[model samples]
Target chain A: MVSKPPPDATRRSEKSRRAIYAAALSLVGEVGYPRTTVEGIAARAGVGKQTIYRWWPSKADVLLEAFLDLSRQAAQEAGQEPYAIPDTGDLAADLKAVLRLTVDQLLDPRFEAPSRALAAEGLVNEPLGREFVTKLLEPQLQLYVDRLRAAQEAGEVRAGVDCRIALELFVSPLAQRWLQHTGPISYDYTDTLVEYALHGIASQPPRSA
Target chain B: MVSKPPPDATRRSEKSRRAIYAAALSLVGEVGYPRTTVEGIAARAGVGKQTIYRWWPSKADVLLEAFLDLSRQAAQEAGQEPYAIPDTGDLAADLKAVLRLTVDQLLDPRFEAPSRALAAEGLVNEPLGREFVTKLLEPQLQLYVDRLRAAQEAGEVRAGVDCRIALELFVSPLAQRWLQHTGPISYDYTDTLVEYALHGIASQPPRSA
Candidate 1:
């Protein structure tokens, strides 16, 4: 087994890591993905370039981890668990609750600029886009899939529905509005999405209802 | 009333306009929005820079109109009316058919590159993003709104449903999948989205059902 580092070394390392993450986020937000450099992050963080390379592979990796850390901090600050969607036996309520938090995260000044910048680069940079989606986005989407699957087993959702696609009915609308500036986003809007997704917009209710 | 241009002059102008549009789309696709210049577009189109300025006040206007023209041409090629979503009275079928055509358009090689480029720029450029949403994206979304409104009048959609948000239940899923590379887009996928939006994913059907 590897030995634990000395306490002083551990504290120092944690400080440097947080600084690097902050620097990475800010640098990427300011200059965008293409122009953001490892050297720039290191300089901003007051850390050596070797320290960054020792911990992360590249600028993309650095930014990805930075975003991940930022999200965790945001979730913690809001008293939310980062990984699980609460299965409170009311799917619509749970979804709306989470999405409202997402709206908060999306609108946070700390998250907005860096996310927009990275997302812009990701559009044209296919490899980076795929990497971020696979590592970051898909995992988050899987949480919804899991929630929907639980709802399905509980008979809260149609058994025939694909949970993955079902989740998108509410999720993607918020995403599009935020990313494309297609409309205003709020608790009211997201609450409406959840209600619509659960009950649909059809005049005739399902036979089960 | 304004005098008509000489027939030859009209023909010449049309040719120049087509060349300019082609140049603008390809250049933006290659170099992205910030790097693309009116000067470069005119040079590539074999027209004087003044020729472009005579028609469009800015590069953004030229690109916007170019995209509009491209969409009209694509719809025509597909034998679709450019502005209308068919109201066949079977709302689901009509929606599925239109979404299938949209899937084809999204996957079209000609539309993909330039659209991705412009969308990437729009993510970070608020004014440009708002302009495109107002002039291009919103009009297309309004077609769905109109169709949903008709359905409401026909007793096909619930009267209380917000048609704008209702359309996003289907439309935004497709948009997010395409924009983010989060999922594969296909006719089947779009058809499923339409079904889900119309009927919802909930277990109990509404009282009407």
Candidate 2:
């Protein structure tokens, strides 16, 4: 168990944390990762450098936490539970609904710029990339895995299929389009992805095979 | 038709071009996009800065052509035609074979460093990303589209399905695994992607619907 801070002190800490997150995200978005500095984030956040260091050890930590917070807030704003994919038993519909939310998050201006900056940095910075993926992305991916496992047990997915790789069929296409600007993204597009992933592009015979 | 240069002059130009490509790729791979310069590439290539400027207008142009040349050389060395996916009337086999080659290319040290450097830069640099995609990636993707179109005509694919999007069900998964290091890539992995893509991930019904 941990001791709680008094109300006023807690409020002050919360305010500082929010400011720091906003500053870190915006600064990284504007300047790109290499140019973003802790001092700069501190200055922009209007908090002393010590205040930031006391909470987070490195700029990467601050940014990572900031991103996590932002995602949680985005999920809340979208009326989504941040931790789990909804399981309605109708797998395609559930997957489509959740992916539509992802489409919204990806398109949201607040999320887009900073996420792109960080993703670009991650491409070359392997340690940071692995850290962010392990902490942030892999967890989110695991939600899909859990959902897929449920799907497998329900006899929706094939028994031998790796749920991890199976999830990528629908997920990575949207990611590639968004990251590489390979194509336009929309609810319709993602819906098509889910459908294609479920039923496949091959011509189905008149009867179930 | 264009006039041919004298044989000796052409040979000298070819040598210079190869040297410039090597210099550009290695320089970008080592120092990254922002720091790679015409002067630096020329110096490394043992050619005058004028030679580089005369051929390519900017560092981006140089890098783009260098990548295109490298890809062509890689494909040729792998015994693949530079522009087309093979069609042996077996869609799954052809896609799997092409993807296996991609797995090899992705793992090759000669391709990995420079491609990652450029791909990282492309993530942040929108215009360069679009330009490279248009000149290099889109053409490659079009080959898949064409193959899928052929598959559609042969009754292997559903006629109404979008070939471009269908191709992503396999291609983007491999790409994401390679780009994000989300998973290990291998021939077996790609072969599985072909299988899952050709058939859906969902358990097939006793008869096709």
Candidate 3:
């Protein structure tokens, strides 16, 4: 997650926020959600508990925002927009490019361990699960939805297609594969998903015989 | 969950095992996986903890086997064999039938909370995730692989298709929807997934221009 202020924010606050973000992610990964506490994050960040409580309401909120900050920072470092997937006009190419970046993120040790911890915790924690889904995951998914809607308008996708559900044809495979270790992630795999998704799966043409 | 066989011989012991299965399932749902214990299950089932331990190793194992048993019983109750997705030779109908059953299971209160707990644990615990996937999940997934391979032989699916990835097109979407609350799940959704998967998303037909 990124600091909310503009790039010109005080170096000290930026450093402290970064420290808190790192502390929040690392501690949760190490001890898990149950044992992870606000005090622990503050201690590890070299700040008072008030610093965290002042910023976020709960441990879940802190960690959620921390992940968002991490993602934004990671995207910026990659020279990509923090939120949007590349359009590139060609849907398949754009999808492949975005999924490749996703592969890198999923395989990154810094991102991997902490993400897995939170995701696992979300499986059982309903409120946290919904919060993470709403604040963090769904917004990212909506980006794909936007791109697909663009494709549909461009006539690359059939007019009758449900952009929301259609996006999942490819998107959810990557998600499940990563979340469940159901399979390996690769450019070839993602590229195939994008290709398979844009066209109909039946031997016939799209939307008709 | 099924009734366990008596240690050596006894009609009444079989009844106790069934009671234990029902108790374990109900307890895990009501109290959740973490709060559920051997003692709680024993007291609820009106059996000694030793009776449970004599049959299963750990609480996780108990819940896991209990789920497996429940699935079998549910399938049998539906008048079908457990683990076999009917190959009535209409691939789409078979998949839809199985997925509908999955929807029913995912929605079942007896299955919901405990399954969520196990799934949440699986996200972080690779060993447990792999164990359950191998024992409880992969076998189910393989049925789709087999069906796809059969479709390939019959010219229902493209000969070039990878059954593993092909199945994910339909399977992962339904899973992502269920696990993450990404979208609404319905027979319509599953039917659409099967159609999308068997064909693909390209603008052109798979066979030729």
Which model scores highest in lDDT? 1
| DockQ-based CAPRI category assigned to the predicted complex of candidate 3 | medium
At residue B142, candidate 1 shows an lDDT of 98
Over the stretch B1-209, how does candidate 3's per-residue lDDT look in tens digits?
A: 98966666667777878888888888876665667899999999999999999988987787778878988988887788888878877777888888888777778777777677777777887887878888787888998888778877876666576778878888899888878777788988888787767655444454332
How close is every model to the real structure, measured as TM-score? 0.98, 0.97, 0.91
**RMSD (Cα, Å) of model 2:** 1.9
True contacts kept of 3: 0.63
Give lDDT for model 1: 0.93
The 10-residue segment of model 1 chain B with minimum total lDDT is B200-209
TM-score of 1: 0.98
Q: B28-104 in candidate 1: lDDT tens per residue?
A: 99999999999999999999999999999999999999999999999999999999999999999999999999999
What is the C-alpha DockQ of each candidate?
A: 0.84, 0.63, 0.59
Runs off by more than 4 Å, candidate 3: A1-9, A206-209, B1-10, B30-36, B206-209
lDDT comparing candidate 3 with the true structure: 0.81
Report per-candidate TM-score of chain A alone.
Answer: 0.97, 0.96, 0.92
Error of 1 at B40 (Å): 0.7
Candidate with more favorable, higher TM-score: 1 or 3 = 1
